[model samples]
Target: MFGFGIYDALIIAGFLGLQFFLSARNSAYWGAIIPVLFISWLTWLLVSGEIKSILAYLLILSIGFIVLLLEWSEGRKALRNRREKELAKMRSYDMN
Candidate 1:
């Protein structure tokens, strides 16, 4: 078992708390912060000897990669939607 230091635990807790609060506010951008928080904390653990095994490193990397992928996918979708709306407006203007 790995024991988390007070500061480490506090940072994690803060991230989780902010995530929850932002989620309740219906802000999707806040969800992207999760990956940043996770990566930083995981890296800290890796360097601090809290996460020692190769398997653990691989597992954390895989999970972080997935989360990052999801975040980017969502962002791309939103960007595409905004572009479509802009194109639609431009087309409408050309017809008039």
Candidate 2:
């Protein structure tokens, strides 16, 4: 009643919590499970009449997946840069 729906608040909190956990892990690899995951949760929630729960879960899952992908790309970029530096050093040594 704080000028917002309870479900909306709950969803926001849930998303924040999930984001924190997933971001801390720095991987959205779990997003790979999301399609089947959301569907399964949706089915169960529907049966239980917990519609809001599924919506919150879906939003969090989607956001978390995207963040994970971003983290992975950054990691890959960092790794590539490191390897390139190593290779350049090796080539320089060969020239010497």
Candidate 3:
């Protein structure tokens, strides 16, 4: 499937899992850094001829982008919820 072997499949799966975990944890720093690192590694692999198929590279890149978008949206939702909660708390204090 797209020139990916079993090991490559496993590595991609693991990377996706890591991305999900980081997103759930709302880790702004590592969430951004990890994808950059992965892209760099992917580039190296392509240049070194380890990954020969363009489709595989594009597939992996697309997956990474999708995960990043999910992470960004989730983070924004969490931040909005946090702010709403803080405002509610302040309003309650004012009422008391």
Best by TM-score: 3
Across residues 36-74, which tens digit of lDDT does each residue of candidate 3 receive?
887888888888888789889888778877776676567
Question: TM-score of predicted model 3?
Answer: 0.63
> lDDT for each of the candidates?
0.68, 0.57, 0.73
lDDT of 1 by residue, 7-59 (tens): 97897567555555443343566656767767777788888988888688779
Which window of 10 residues has the lowest lDDT sum in candidate 1?
Answer: 18-27
TM-scores for every predicted model: 0.55, 0.48, 0.63
Query: Mind giving the per-residue lDDT tens digits that candidate 2 earns over 1-96?
Result: 024788978975665444444433434454334335545655676667655565665675577556545554554555567678999999999999
User: Which whole-number lDDT from 0 to 100 does residue 74 have in model 3?
Assistant: 72
Which 10 consecutive positions of candidate 3 have the poorest summed lDDT? 19-28
Off by over 4 Å in 2: 1-52
Off by over 4 Å in 3: 1-31
Candidate 1: C-alpha lDDT: 0.68
